[model samples]
Target chain A: MTKFNFELTKEIELLRLVTVGSVDDGKSTLIGRLLVDTKGAFEDQLMAVRKKKGTVKVSSAAEIDLAMLTDGLSAEREQGITIDVAYRYFATPKRKFIMADCPGHEQYTRNMVTGSSTANAAIILIDARHGVLAQTKRHTHILGLLGIPHLIVAVNKMDLVDHDQATYEKIREEMKEYCAKQGVRDLICIPMSALTGDMVSVRGDNMDWYKGDTLLETLESMSVLDDLDEKPFRMPVQLLNRPQTADLPDYRGFMGTIASGTVKVGDELVVKPSGKISTVKEIVTFDGNLQEAFAPQSITIILNDEIDISRGDMLMHVGQEDSDSKFLTANVCWIGDEPLETRKKYLIKHAASEVKAMVSEVNFKTDIHTLAQDEADELAMNEIGRVTFKLQQPLNYDKYADNRTTGSFIVIDSFTNNTVGAGMIV
Target chain B: MSEHKLTQLKALEAESIHIIREVVAEFRNPVMLYSVGKDSSVLVHLARKAFYPAPFPFSLLHVDTGYKFKEMYDFRDAFCEEIGADLIVRKNEDAINKGMNPKEFGVARCCQALKTTGLLDALEEGGYDAAFGGARRDEEHSRAKERVFSMRDEFGQWDPKNQRPELWNIYNGRIHDGESVRVFPISNWTEMDIWSYIREEKIEIVPLYFAKERPMIERGNMLIPYYEENKDQLLEGEVPKMIMSRFRTLGCSPCTGAVRSDATNMDEIVIEAAAARRSERETRIIDHGSNSMEDKKKEGYF
Candidate 1:
């Protein structure tokens, strides 16, 4: 096959994942083992780390701190704690993976949210000795909240417990019960020793009692494409690609990124807010003509005839028809220093559109540990709460559970010009 | 194209284009910071595509340190002419004339006075409300925490501890007067992705990136390039050695190091970069100083 053909096939088979776990739970070790055993680590990097191991004043007792392979910062090396989301790319013959190694500290929840926001799957690590801690519960709840379809509970440090089946089963049962309570349906549990390379990319003799697909095999087999493109068509106009100069006075085109679904030429579409109907004339990009443009693609669309359209306008399928726009009831993860105050006007940016929104009411706050709902007037830092928002204008959106691209938004602090919180429309 | 993969790249591209458009729509006066590097080249390319057939809405801002490779300036001028984009060049000639060499004030201080101050002064003078940068999150730890619409205070300071939560593709570029926002459209892209895109797009870059015969000296593992008049600052232990070398990253000539390589073309460079373990910044003597990038960033260094 040609190089282009190989790359096309490889791109189709790639899996993007974000790993989350509390401090020192062997998340980095798992990634390192996966990279090392798979021969993903370059020869020079391995040798350099080995030669400079204990000799470096920054590192701890050498022995190839596997975390060094991913964590690029010198401060991160000295602290032995991941502060920001570090992305690493590696490929197996079966599949390519781009893993976002997010910081596990509770304080860096924003970083974790950013990392896992674009992930198709999540690997939530749990230490066998500690069982399911507060941070583990937090991560699981956040994953569920983020609408991550696939969850892998990697019960790391199993070797410390002699790779006992009972311990793994107990932790798995607890996680399963908690996830079920939080409405997380798709979850898989595996026991492994990240430090010793057990049940990571390949099966190990240490886990003879466990029979399932290896982590690598599971990663390869998981379906990523089906989950993203199955949603409805939603396009947010980004710009108007028409030059109103003398050369192209009559030329007009609505340019935007398609948030979801496929749009083809001759398809009937409705421009939201203005409620103007138009037929797709052409889909244009920097490259040659595209017959049709699908979800997530940024392209300029020319209509058969000109209709009034501007930025922040949504284009949807006319036949399918969307539900009546109304006030949004959403589960919000408050990230600001100050607690969320009800009845405050803030800038709410959803997808490609931004509008003035006010918090109509506070529904309740979720307890990260207990997964219980409580009536609260305000939401503090790292608090998850359900709130009602009244927008100045109705926004065209889907339910967060159905479509993450259209249903999510961030609340900006008007005075400080800071992004204070994140919300997912229910 | 397959239905699935097309959807993925489309989504990423759409978001990026939306961001570029927002930078144009929201800011009163916005300019793009072009470094003549792959990242900035891709940024300019995206901008052209974002608002095609309508010459880029914003001007290109280049902070010339006067110590850059001659090839970079040549490429910059040629690219600007070809794209029909307005170019604004800023330099700290006053400081340079005052003997403010990198050797005197160290790499961090020199960069602070020359590049960062030059950029700030240009922004202030141009009355730009927003500046589009080509910084990617995958480049460094601090950058990974950066927002697509990064807000800079009145003094142009970045507070790492407190940052806005960026959700979905929606960016909030709203800021007060006298405070400008630094917009990064390609924050999600990695080093490999930049190279891959450059290769795929056939974007033209400086020839200094490819290996060629150049006068240089050996200083610690890095090949220090020798320029006129700056040879007196060489340490006693460092030896002057002539070798075929190229710059992995473009910066002030004194601080940036050259690597010995035969990868004179894009394809060979890509292969060599892929196999190389060390980061592009590792060879630079500027970053070798104690948390230099972070310290500079804290002091409003771009």
Candidate 2:
């Protein structure tokens, strides 16, 4: 009855991870193993999976169809393929994890991008028997573009490869090379059989030569709070909290979730687009007033002097504000079925600001298999490429590598309001 | 002086606050669907924080089935008044006028007419362009693939297959005049997380969540409470018993089931929830089938 130590688990950090691989790379099996081994999967959920008719055996030792655990849609079950992203949750005493189960089909690259967008780390599965495939490179390239801080290459299906040390090493070498080319800075390779539970959660004795930590260990120990705290201050004003109450008639507060950096009381801040400067009078929350607040904390800020800071305006550290520009160069992943037409107006939403924008030019598109830049006039659905955009107004932003929150944006079709593209400031 | 990083709970709170703020900022008229459940209690708490020191700009909509437990209505009225927010209660007057009930019509049709149709009717009447719900991805299978900003057609029909791809934290709230958006601020939260946060924040919930010796009748592995709302649904041979039970989920008295447990306090409930094998949805008879929830959602059931 006391198996779950709830008292010992307090104030645990949240880690967001995503799974990416080709369609048959055992991504679902790996996730199913993590949930089951950690006791995160409930009995009813497992029973439902076990009760499915014609369940495919993913691992020899596993009694349940692990891949069926995450395929939620009836159509997905019928086709035996994932079409969209499914989010899963689990927890250990030390941390809470939100795993984004992304599909690997070429047509569903949009789903993978959506899943990887907020992930702090990504686990890219590489079949040990197939070595590195085109889907691996494509996912790696997309992950690199999304600026996922950590990459764990799980060399799965080792049992099919006879658990040979040479095969794992070969795939690891090729992945390391390709990941490096894709600008993956932090990478770790592990050899495991997701089906057989070898080196996934508890290291099964099948792979004695593998010396690295298990997949669960690697995820649990990943440092999620990157240099976000050290980055320059950026907070997009989401709302102007003007509480004209009887007791508090003069309250004019700015509200937002600090995109990055830390802010303290009496700190000097400049409101963008107006260049108005003011000092922080107080940081307010429902609990109480705070002297200091940092990135990802939603709080209200009161200024020493009155300023016309409206929604969509950025409050930044003095001399650290990104200059506004009407033209932007960036890499984009087209997600809409409708091809990207140059000179067609689209709504570009970045942070809290939305403005009319048009694709000025398509610099080039990258081939998924060869990683080669080819000339293309239009970016089709699920295509990754570099494109230039001309905005109707000046936008203040930073490079995607420097600040993901402020640098990333989504392209929306003006007529349909569908998210057509995901762009990163270069 | 603390570290700059936020705990998991705090981070979730911050995220939820941000989303609530965004909904208020973008849409002209937005409403939060408060079901008087644990999730709705947390959502109301977050909404209170989202616009502290100022009156909430939107109203809290409660779709009443006229079959909820009496304790739920009492809690809902008192809780809304305590927070000083506007509350709008809507009912399927047409269905009620026709004498529609679960036992006679069935759970699926009853839900469709009472909850889904009632919700859509209220939303259209209020001209609300965006409505927030307390749906979590971990609760059901189909919900795991739902977008934070789920778009619905002019008639409030959801096309799950053609949903717009959501990326990053940038949400697309733009929609045509007739269309509306259903935003889930706590989409990523799990059931355990909900209980843990409830205990941490000390949020007041309905007393139904606490175990008590209430009159109940056994119905096919379900512990159905013997109340005025469900008195007529009893079979010939069934008998009511005074059992120590509590609800895992809340709905109409006839559709929801109670689990036998001794967990009366928040701490005990958290421990029990952590160790329990069955999911919370299993107790809600409306979600018995594999595709019922999905089908209901497509018909605009929040």
Candidate 3:
């Protein structure tokens, strides 16, 4: 193979965003519009869709099946609804985007959690005509609980209201008030007719009274790197690459992806739970050596001296000690066929650490429509609640709001081996 | 490194390494499934780095489907020799000689008997408690909800809806006897991310990935190659054409297809792959027919 000198000139800024809304709120159409208006659609694909027979010609507006743009599955096309998360990719000169269009139905709440898990920003669509509905509040509340820093409430179907600003503001104010009550600080509201090209990418003159930036502009201007700087150094060991061959018999390295912060060669480090101290010897990638590594980067590390280190061990800055505690308060989204029962033993996975845990108590369950917390004994599907868990072994963690990488966990049912709930440490 | 605010690739790599280590620490007997593909190459590369200063901890298990490109074997052998790791090759010759043609028994059944069954036999014989694969979520819709530590029953069935919720980076690879977990260190990586990582890391892959001169036949818009005995399977319209082509994704020969391209190097291939109209799996003849991929996945085909 020829030696290729690959230089990354432009920093690849890929944003994962999910479009969420209530049923019949045109969330899919809004995404389809964003893709279409930006010229993200392929010529052959558009032409082929137009040629399809017996296609629904809704509103007689060019007869374009907007849902066809995103609903890629045959079943989804036949049913006219998103059954699963449909990921679509498009790139502008500024940045690349991977949009996850999640289902709007209430039963597919688990699908929504799957879609928005990795999203940096969420586009919660609300039909202007209907204002904020039950599903709308559920999605927004989910986004806020998921720790999505930025949100764009795309009040779609402005054409239905003759592009009325009053309807947009009424919904926007209601949404803003609801989000504030739910502790969502950063929110942007935009009125858009996803059917027609209005304030999606290009500025639509119909909404001249609106002073804020367009949807695309708002997304572009949003800070790509938020408070990731505040997160402490954390690298979860995934594998131990100990080549036992005759040529390099003494090779011992800790391989894993860095969850947050940075680690350099010769930096003092500490392994979690076991609390073993070590110094960074070398940082290795597939190509060659690396000087340092940070969050999201997968790399192998060789320590100066061999320490008893294995997988599920976390490597962090040595000076900063992590607390090994057995109990934590967390906000959980129950997603099991069986409702969460108190005192049930479940396996808890926090970062690279796994421990046996049981729900000690149910604090309160949040009302999906009202965002109100009511004391409850159990949680069902699509329900959000605060719960306390007692762990069999001490887990090293930070607050979920502080460091998302180390502060989240999943509750796995011991009997059926199903993931019952996802929790963010409070 | 100081100038760049850790790209998503870096984060993914770190996380994968972490997962790999965790699997090794938690599981008693673990083996990596090497398919001689880009994703597996990344997996091996990460494995080498995960336990640097020492040899790779686990052995590599390759389940030969009996209809692979000859070059893939050569590449696999060469890589094993370079890394000085043990390579375990298993094949279903009994089923093959029994005259089980994939075209007759259906793609899903063929995959189950040839790939999944063969893999199960090898795992049972080798007593492997866990197996690491290079499967990624971005590859398909069904894969999107897959957990990093995906547990399988004694029969190796993947219960999609019943998977453990994987939040943050915590992975639960726990399973009782007769059950094992399929660990994916790079579950979040997309096709673009894999290519970029391959380029950035300068990981060596099969030469078939780059465009080259080869005898190929056009079958339903896909470039099918005429290799060995399979040459006679071509119909009248399928004429051999010497086109510059490369396989975007690798699979069994009969199932995988090559795309016509001039991208002889990584840089050109990345651009072309990024702009490709169809998905990587769209060209696979086996998946093109009926609900084969999903069906095969349900029956424990990796």
Q: What is the C-alpha RMSD of each candidate to the true structure, in Å?
A: 3.6, 2.5, 4.4
Candidate 2's residue-wise lDDT over A1-426, tens digit each? 556566566657789999999978888888888888887777667776774445543222266777777766775777778888989999887889998999889888888899999999999998888888888888898998999999999999999989999998888888888877777899999999988898988898888887889988998888876777889999999999997889989999999999999999999999987889999999999999998899889999999998898999999989888968999888999999899977878999999999899889999999976678999989999889999999999888999999999999999998877889999999
**Cα lDDT tens digits for candidate 1, A287-346:** 755888776777778898778888888888886555436588899988788888789888
Q: Which regions of candidate 1 are displaced past 4 Å?
A: A1-14, A31-62, A68-98, A202-205, A227-230, B7-15, B226-244
DockQ of each: 0.41, 0.72, 0.34
| Candidate 1 local lDDT, B206-283, one digit each (tens) | 888889988888876778888667768678877666798888787777778889998788776766665565667666
For every candidate, the chain B TM-score is 0.92, 0.97, 0.95
DockQ agreement of candidate 3 with the native complex: 0.34
Question: In candidate 3, how many Å is residue A106 off?
Answer: 2.8
With candidate 3 superimposed using the best TM-score fit, by how many Å does residue B234's alpha carbon deviate from the native? 3.9
Instruction: Compose the digit string of candidate 2's lDDT tens values, residues B1-302.
Output: 24887778888999999999999999999999999999999999999898887877899999999989999999999998998879999999999999888788888888999999999999999999999999999998789989999999999988776777888888999998899999999998899889999998899999999999999999877898997555766899999999999998888887889999998999999998878878888889888754378888888888
TM-scores vs. true structure, each candidate: 0.90, 0.96, 0.86
Write one digit per residue (lDDT tens) for candidate 3, span A63-182: 577655554454455666666666666666556677777788888787788778778899998888889888888888888988988899998889889889899999989988999997
Please compute and give the TM-score of the first chain of candidate 3 against the native first chain: 0.93
Most DockQ-accurate candidate? 2
Q: Identify the leading candidate in terms of TM-score.
A: 2
TM-score per candidate for chain A alone: 0.92, 0.94, 0.93
Interface RMSD of each: 3.6, 1.7, 4.2
i-RMS of candidate 2: 1.7
